[model samples]
Target: MPYDPPPELAGLSLAQIAEQVAARNLPPLDTWDPPETEHSGMRITADGRWFHRDSPITRPAMVRAFASLLRREDDGRYFLVTPHHKQAIDVEDAAFIAVDCKADGDALAFRLNTDELVLAGPHNPLRAQGDADTPAIYLSVRHGCEARLDRSTWLQLADIALADGGDLSVGSQGATFALRPA
Candidate 1:
């Protein structure tokens, strides 16, 4: 089956987006602590492209499946883990990219390149770093993994912050996040 990306964020209500988020059933990567470790030779580029042994993994399903198994250790290394095996994968920047985002009520939702929905809140906090001249924003995905917001998505988020109060900040789930690092 072909992968169908979710509809535009602007068209969906917060409740609907939340429902979709709740419906997702990702692998329990945390519980699976495989004793054996190996190298997967897979790398996720800074631009969110997945490659294996210098070949692009073009299949969305395969990419999504691999993404679901991803786990980042405290030392900042990424691995695809199972109950019996753990394999390393290199990440140039973030593990995923926030391809799109939307602001609904007091919450913000982001859709990743892997078709994963992330609702920015206490658990999934947004962080902005770098200087005013070149700022980078990221959202926590899961298991110590983060997603870098794409250019367009960052612009959308900027617009939202401006419209809210022009303070270069946005509030979600009772937390206020500065769009740029202070």
Candidate 2:
């Protein structure tokens, strides 16, 4: 079935519709899903070495950048990174750290270190896991760049970051910019 506009949006202008979409301020849809993930902690090596660990590891020199990182793409997705943690854990050698994300309302946490990617979900006790292979870092850009995020633009960013020996992180922190294509 075709989607019909809600009564509240019936008389809105194209610009208004666009604005609401950009701000994520539109009325909740019948199928909205609540955000189900959060970050608990992260660790990076002091000497900038990446390793994998199975327990809580510490690195003191890795500092959280104060300003948020924003990466605007030509398509319509924004990549943003901000300092959301209270304390920045230090990473040295192969060590592990924890990260918490919301899942089904409860906190789903995991421990990620040099090589391991642990995903904890509220629904299951057995941790869903993976490997980082390489450390994922966050970067941000200016709000003005929001006009450039799109599929092609994001692909370009991914290409550039990968070419520079970096891979895009999978979660919202790794890519938190909003889409505001022109």
Candidate 3:
């Protein structure tokens, strides 16, 4: 089946976005600590491309399925977890890419390359790093995973920040986020 992207963030209300986020039923990666471990030889590029043995994984469904099983350990390692086994995967940068973003009322919604919907809030905050010359923005996805905003999505969030104030900050879910270095 072909992957159908979600409707644009602009058209969705905060409640609607929350509904979509809640609708996703993921595996219990946190509880499933399988005794078996292996290296899957899968890697996620900085730009959100999934590769195995250096060849791109072209199927969207496969990518999405793998992404759902991804978990980041406290030691900064990523793994694709199943009930029976946990396989290591290399991540060039973030595990996912925020390909699209929009400001909805007091909330900010983002769509990942895997078509996952994330709402920026207290739980899933946005973090800005790097210096003025080279800036990078990331949104916390879940289970210690983050999504780096792509160029256009970063620009869209920047515009929203500037529209709100000169502080280069935006508020969502009763929390404020700075778009630039302090």
Candidate 4:
């Protein structure tokens, strides 16, 4: 059988857990984060891995790769969430994967995979709404910097890019998403 902490500890103070862990008095399975702030969430795994939703969580002293889903609100603030970690990474630095527009008609029939980079110039409502204006940045393999990535990676990347001011057009043929610069 596995050992589980009491339910009360699920939302306990992060400071308390940290202090115990630092002092080596606790088993290091507890996690915490400040409340009322974006990315202020925490979780504890069955294996005793303490996770902080505000930042990347990995095995102690280990580097882990993470990805997230992004959505742009009408107010302009970007909303992002990830299963690996609740922390949000700036979209500007993140990469995106887009489908080939030339092959696909204007019906917004495209896909975004992970590990591919997506870049755009500035905001143009006309382009975002799929009017006469075209998005500053579309999907292309060249934009990926010659790196080959699986479909999953591209999708993950697209999820984050779209959350950060990225827009998608639903056309007769397919769907297309764009990442415009701030």
Candidate 5:
């Protein structure tokens, strides 16, 4: 066995888990060396919806808990890892969605669908995929994971870009993203 959280911790509500995550005292996921397990047959859609066996997972807390355990390897595999298991999961586009954002001066902070925060720039550099006609934006989260920017969040970033000489080189904590015009 690896380093699993106490069984009691799994019984806590998502909010309680969030507090622990915020406090940064949860299980050390990166350090866990669990054996690889079979694919979980789960997929996270581009919009951040999760599906298991082609059925949507309706529980918000379940989704959040799974999201917390998500990890992406350099080989391009996504896994929902625990101390006891490293179950592969499919990601159609991205593992997370950035739905909202705030710009405090030049620093930018994005709120992901997973209820996690991603600060734009430097270590979390924002980037774009696709092309000018249909740009797919993404923000790198820690641990080699990323969150795709949802439409509304993209628009917010675009607005900031327009205000700043048609570019998004301004973000929270002095982070900068460059968004070229379509």
Candidate 6:
């Protein structure tokens, strides 16, 4: 969806704009379903890199702008949706990577590759796929999309993951999510 920024942001600094964008009120993606369109030039790599026509999108600002436009539909495909258009994009893994995370008191908040923030708790739980020795970590982003946690970030999260009996759990905000679902 096209964001018509509040007129007040016109004079803000880049950092300020980024902060606003990070916390901006987003349209309810669940409510949007425009007709599907095609755009084969855009691709999100396995490591969360964006490319256009086989060239890496090196500009961080442009990448962030594109990230804001992404939407994953129910069919397990990703798209860039606007009020008027919904165009397909290739996602090798996921659209974003959970690069790092920090704690707000006991609440864990993750920082995705897009710089979007998500807290891990009951609403946005952490998940582990495959065997514990080598697993894929994922954090729910929004809607039905998710961000895969890179090994370093997943290890960081593991450090804080609480041990409950034989299961690994992430305890925050009075809830605990077992990494290996019980």
**Which prediction has the highest lDDT against the true structure?**
1
Q: What 10-residue stretch in candidate 4 is worst by lDDT?
A: 117-126
Worst 10 residues of 2 by lDDT: 100-109
Question: What digit string (tens of lDDT, one per residue) describes model 1 on residues 100-151?
Answer: 9888889999999998889998999999988888899999999999999999
- Predicted candidate 6, C-alpha RMSD: 6.5
| lDDT digits (tens) for residues 36-87 of candidate 6 | 7778589999999999999999977788778877887788988888777888
**Largest TM-score belongs to which candidate?**
1
**Which lDDT tens digits does candidate 3 get at residues 80-174?**
99999999999999999999998888899999999899989999999999998778999999989999999999989989988898678889899
Off by over 4 Å in 4: 1-36, 39-68, 82-88, 93-95, 102-108, 115-135, 138-182
Relative to the true structure, candidate 5 reaches a TM of 0.81
lDDT-based ranking: 1, 3, 5, 6, 4, 2
Candidate 4 at 52: error in angstroms? 13
- The residue-level lDDT of candidate 4 at 8 comes to 32
Which stretches of model 1 miss by more than 4 angstroms? none
lDDT of 4 by residue, 61-107 (tens): 22112222333233433333333333432333213334321111222
Model 6 pairs in collision? none
Of the candidates numbered 3 and 5, which has the greater lDDT value? Answer: 3
Candidate 2 ranges beyond 4 A from true positions: 1-22, 31-151, 167-182
lDDT score, residue 109, model 3?
93
Greater-TM-score candidate between 1 and 6:
1
User: Per-residue lDDT for 97 in model 6?
Assistant: 96
Question: Residues 1-182, candidate 5, lDDT per residue (tens digit)?
Answer: 33333234225444454454466533467898799989999999877899999999987778877887889988999998898999999998888888877664556667777666556768788887788888888888866789988888889878877787764555545555566433
lDDT of 5 at 144: 72
